[model samples]
Target: MKKPGRLLGSVSAAAFAILASSPALASGTLAGSTITNTVTVNYQVGSVAQTATSASNSFKVDRKVNVTVAETGSATTQVSPGQTAAVTTFTVTNLSNAALDFALVAAQQSGGTAAHSGTDNFDVTNVKIYVDTNNNGSYDPGTDLEVSYLDEVAADASKTVFVVADIPLSLSTGSVAGVTLTATGREGGTAGSQGAALVETTGADSANTVDTVFADGAGSSDSARDAAYSAKDDYTVLAAALTIVKSSKVISDPLNGTTNPKAIPGATIEYCISVANAAGGAGASNVAISDPLPVTVTYDSGYGIFLNGTVTSGVCNADGAAGGSYSSGTVSGTLSSVAAGATKTMRFRAVIN
Candidate 1:
């Protein structure tokens, strides 16, 4: 009743106040009925005994930047053709008055082989980054994460997410870097709203997101061979055709469905993909097998498998892109190029819905 008195939503309101004040129009982020990154509001209501009403919305965004690979950093060290180094920067700008709800935290590899290896030193950790949630260039309600706490980053102020991804030194040698990554976050404590509802609703523009990437290029320090790029430059490469040999492909492995059948919740069937190479295939590159994790899963790096990718209810992002079935798990790992045609077998276990 009474239009629920006006919803409160802001993505980065504090940034606006801290950066520089905009007058005249009382405008920009504060002027709009909704703003992303920051959150704050003031309302005037008719006196008298009336019902107390409230409203909330969220935001989301998907952005990325690709960088080039380097050979080495130290002068004593030689630049090798196989080894690589690079960094990416993702900026989250708050336009709201109230502090940005979340902070910049972990980095997730949405669909790539480069992940959080213990060797990472410049990795941006212990922070919560926010997304537009809806990629609408604006932040609102429902599309945010509320797990971590973050005050306003202040309007006009920006937060940077640093990522130092390294390439493997093997036959595959990295014709490319890593896969796409998406920074996720919800409204932060600074929003001062009622908070997110786990079961009530999942709104767009409500969640936080930062998805912009910048990649560079560099020459191998020890190019005991020929020289490629003199300096680091950004480039995009298609997925390399890794050597793979099929050992098993069971669409309906009733036995696996019962025995190893995805232990993930609601998983009805399981697809086990395993492979072996004479060179152990790849060395220690991150191998990301995308399919569907229904309940919750774990990427057992030791076994190169996901132990808990369950059969959950979350909707898939792209169709036919992430692959609906793990009939034959793809390898984005590290190892020899497989003798240009070395034979290797892989087993992908999928849980049938």
Candidate 2:
């Protein structure tokens, strides 16, 4: 017959190995789940079989509350002045052991450093929050469902969120607007409706009751173990800054030929208008320049208006395609486009009255 001590030791080792091979649940043991442990002892006394004895204990699993908030992209979101429905994306994940609700907020920063290297200089208008309706990872203005808070988010799952806003008009290029998306952990286990704010259990743990414990780390605008987290994002403006300048010079007169000519009667005068776009600014299109001729000069119909000319050293060149109109005492021309860090000129020659 086998020794009792050796047989019991072999059985215990086999039981431990079986327990270790069991797979772990995604969210661990569910909260409010009753976990019971029982031990049974059987032995033979004085060569006779004895009855088995058993002991048992049970406790309820506690809830572990946790969450994470992160900006979806690495670079600053590029935007335009007066743009509507500009979007910034973020992800909110539930790390808790039970389902939970989260309240969302889009907060603007004032006069400080922004995410991805920039300074906050302005605020966006009509800021709102929306949840991704189709998991497409892109913001859909009318298709996405707008909500003030997330409801019944499953544990270990994530939800994509959008911060939609309108950009103010006349914002300069490189202007930045910093924003933070905050998600506060709230009560869960409900469906359709938003639950109340989550509260941590402060007293001792009760074996029969499930207690909540916060386990979230610090975020952009929140502290650790606060049941809330935040992530930062910013919008940078991209626009064109255009400037126009006009200059006049006497080309010839009745007494001079391509020499030191003066603005006298019957003298040929050349006019130049330059349009320059600032560097690092957006390209301008369909640029139109209109100049009304002064009473002292007459239209030089012999030399028609020169459109889409070139400028060098702050001087407009006369080499341009002849494509402009002179009517109603005004000179008008329309340019196709003026690229950034580039200049276009319009030139014409007239005679002094």
Query: How many backbone overlaps does candidate 1 show?
Result: 114
Q: How displaced is residue 22 in candidate 2, in Å?
A: 6.7
For each candidate, what is the lDDT? 0.31, 0.86
Instruction: Please count the clashing residue pairs in each candidate, in the order shown.
Output: 114, 0
Candidate 1 residue-wise lDDT at 279: 43
TM-score list, all predictions: 0.24, 0.83
Whole-model lDDT for model 2 versus the true structure?
Answer: 0.86
lDDT for model 1, on a 0 to 1 scale?
Answer: 0.31
TM-score of candidate 2 on Cα atoms, chains taken together = 0.83
lDDT of 1 at 305: 32
- Per-residue CA lDDT of model 2 for 158-204, tens digit only, reads 99999999999989999999999999988874787888988899977
Give, for candidate 2, the lowest lDDT window spanning 10 residues. Answer: 1-10
Model 1, span 1-353: residue lDDT tens: 01122354333456456545645221133311332333344445675545554444443322211122222221111122233333333444443332333322333322333322211212222223233334454323355332332344443444433333343333232233322222222333334542231121223322344322222123222131111112221212212334332222223334555455433444433233222233422332333434434444322232233321211132111111122223233333222223322332222343433
